[model samples]
Target: MAVNRACHLIEELGCGTVLNGMLDYYPTKEEVQKVTVNPQRINKLLGVNVPMDQFINILERLEFKCNLISSDKLELEVPSFRLDITEDADILEEIARIYGYENIPAADLEGNATAGVKTENQKFMDKVKENSIACGLNEILTYSFVSPRGVDKINLPENDEKRNFVKIMNPLGEETSVMRTTLIPNMLNVLATNVSHKVEEAYAFECGNTFTPQNGLPVETKKYCIGMYGKEVDFFSLKGIVETILNNVGLKGYEIESETTNSTFHPGRCAKVVYNNICVGTFGELHPDVIENYNLGQRVYVAEINADLVFENITLVKRYSALPKYPSTSRDIALIVKDEVFVKQIEDIIKANASDILESYKLFDVYKGSQIEEGHKSIAYSITYRSAEKTLTDEDVAKVHDKILSELSEKLNANLRSN
Candidate 1:
C-alpha cells in the first residue's frame, strides 16, 4: 500500500518512481484474535434475539470471519488490523455497529420502587434535635464558612489544631473565607445578634459540620453547639440541660472533667464531657474576653460537643425493671479539698469505693469562703443507697459511706467537713 501511494505521488510530479533494494521492516504487526460467540448471550445483551444466520451475516459484513462451533455458538476471527476487537463483547459490538442501534427493541423497566426511609444515623440526629428542642432550645443553622478571624475572636492559641483551617480559594469575602473549626463562635454570633435586637433571652443550638485541615483534604465532622443567655441561667444550669440531652441520646458512664485552660471558655468554669477516656464535648460559661468580643453584655454559656464522638459512645442496649418495691436511704457528706479539685474527682472516688447498693449521687453544693482555707473549697454530695433484691440496711449504707470517705481522704487529701 505504501509503495503504490509513493508511485502515484511520483507520477503526479515530474520525478519518475524506480524500485530499489527495498527492506520492509514493519515491526510486529497485530495477529488475528479469536473469541467464542454465544447467540443467547448476544440476545440477552441486545434484548432482541437475532437468528444465528442473521448474526453470522452481520459479522461477515463487518469483515469478521465466523465458523460454526456448536448449534448456538460460533468462533469469530477478528481482523488483524482491528486491534480493538479482543473479546466476545467486542465481536458483538461489531455486529451491533453493522446491525444499527435504532433497530433494537425498547422495553419499559419492570420493578416496584420502594420508598426511602431514614438511616440509623439520620434517625439518631433527628432524636438529638427532638431532645434538644424538648430541653428548651431552638435549632439554628449557620454557614459552615466562617471568617478566619473566628479563631482569633475565640482566642485560640497559635498552635491549636483548630487554627489550621481550610481556606476557600474563591471566597465571597474575607469574613466568609475559611471553614469553621468550632461551632461555638457561630452560636455566639447568634446570641450577639439577639442582643442587638434587644431580645432579653436567647438559647439556640446548631447541628452542623466543621472542617479541620488534614494531610490533603480537610476533615469534616458533625458538631453540636448550644448557646444560652438569659435570667435564672448559670453554668450548672446549662450543664443540666446538656446532660439531659446527652441522657436522651442514650449516653451513660460519662465523666465531667474540669477544663480550666481553654481560651474559648472562662477558666475554672469549663467542663469537658469524657466517655471511654475520650473528650466528646466541652461546655461552660464563655470567656469574658470572648463575650466582650461578641458584644454580649452579660455572661453567656455555650456547649460545643463533637456529635461523632457522642455517636461512638452512645449506648445501644437499654435495660428496664419494674418500680423498686424496696425503700431507699440518702446520706449527705461534705469534703474540704483544694480549689483545683473537680467534682468529677470526688465522684470518681465515691464510685470506686461504693458498694452495689449505691443507687445514685449528685453534687448539691460547692462552697469557698472564710469558712474554708484560702486555697480550699468544701463540696458536698447527697448519695442514695438502694437495692433491687432488698431494701439496703443501715449497716450496708454505712459501710459504703465510710469507704468513700476513706478513699477521698487518702487519695485526694480531703478533710471531712463536720460542724
Candidate 2:
C-alpha cells in the first residue's frame, strides 16, 4: 500500500525521474511549508469524538505524515494527490468523508426570506410586449449584426444620419459585417422569405437595439418595428394597430404627421409619429423601389417606434376619472378643402378653437372623386361636445361646432360642403 501511494504521489508531483533509478526526488523550496491541522477543530466541526492518536493513524493510512506541533495542532505533509487539502477545515472534511457521511447530523437553515417585486421599468416593458402580442402581431427576435448592403437597399439618402452604422472589425463575413442601423430591412427580408415559401400573410414585430456611430463610439438605442403584408393590409390598417399599441401604453397627445421626406416610404401614404414635439418614429407603405429591391411581391406597411423615447416619456402613474354624469351631443360637419390641407391640420384647428367643451373629434370619412372639384376633396368629421356639470343640448354643441368650422374655413380655406 505504501509503495502504491508513493508511486501515485510521484507521478502527480512530476517526479518521474526519481523512478528511473538515476536521481533522488527532492522537494521544491515552495513545497517545504507544512500544512497544520487541529484535532479539536475537527471534532467541533464534524461532531466527532476523535483522539489525537486516532487522527494521526487515519492520516497515515491516506499517506500523510504528521508531527505534533502543539497540544491540539499537528503539522502534516500534504501528498500531491490530495492537492485540495489546504486549510484546517479541508483536512477536517477529508476525515469526515473517509470516516462516514452518515455520522454528521443535518440541521435546518436559519434566515429571513424576502419576496421579489418587479421594477417600474420591467413592468412597463412587460406591458408593452403584452400589448404588441395582443395586436395580432407576433414578436420576433433578429440579429443586431446585419449586412452593410441593407442600408443601401433601403434607399436611405447618402447624407441620412441613419446611414452611419458601426462596422465590425473582425466580421464573420460580408453578410454580418456591421451593426444594424434600422430594423426595416431585416423585417422586409423576413416577409419576403415567408412569401417565397407560399405563406400568404405575415404580421410580425421586434423590440431591439440599433447601433449608430457617434463621437468615435457606438451608441445603442432601443426601437420597436412592426411589419404587415397581405391583401387586406393598407395605410389605415397598420395605423389603427399603431394607435392601439400607443393607447394601451398610456401615451397621450401624440400625432401622426404626414411624411414626405423619406424615400424608403411611398409618398403621400406615410407619416411620422410625433410625441412631445419629438419625431418618435415613422410608418407608411413601403415604396415600390424598396419592395422590388427586396423581391417582395406584395405591398407592405411598416411602422417603427422609438421605444427608448416612448418609455422615457411613458406615464406609469395612472390616474382615473369618474365617468361623465350627463349625456354628450355630437355633430357631423363635411368640408371641401384643397388637397394640400391635411386631416391633421383640420383636427388641430377644431381642437384649438373648441376649448374645454370639445370632448373629441374624429375624421369619419375622406372622399376624393370625379364628382368633387379637380383640386379639392370632401372630408367629413364627427365632433362631440360634452360638459362635466350638465347635459349639453344641440344649441350648445352647434355653437362650438360652428366655431370649429369657421376656423377651418378661415385658416385652411375650407368651404362647408352641402348634403
Top of the candidates by TM-score: 2
- Candidate 2 lDDT by residue in tens digits, 239-330: 98999888888777788898998899999989998997899999999999999998887799999988888888877678888988988888
The models' CA-based lDDT, in order, is: 0.87, 0.86
The TM-score of predicted model 2 comes to 0.74
Clashing pairs in 2: none
- Alpha-carbon deviation at 82 in model 1, angstroms: 52
Candidate 2 ranges with C-alpha deviation above 4 Å: 1-119, 214-217, 416-419
Worst 10-residue lDDT window for candidate 2 reads 17-26
Stretches of candidate 1 off by over 4 Å are 1-109, 213-218, 367-376, 413-419
Residue 216, model 2: Cα distance from true site in angstroms: 7.5
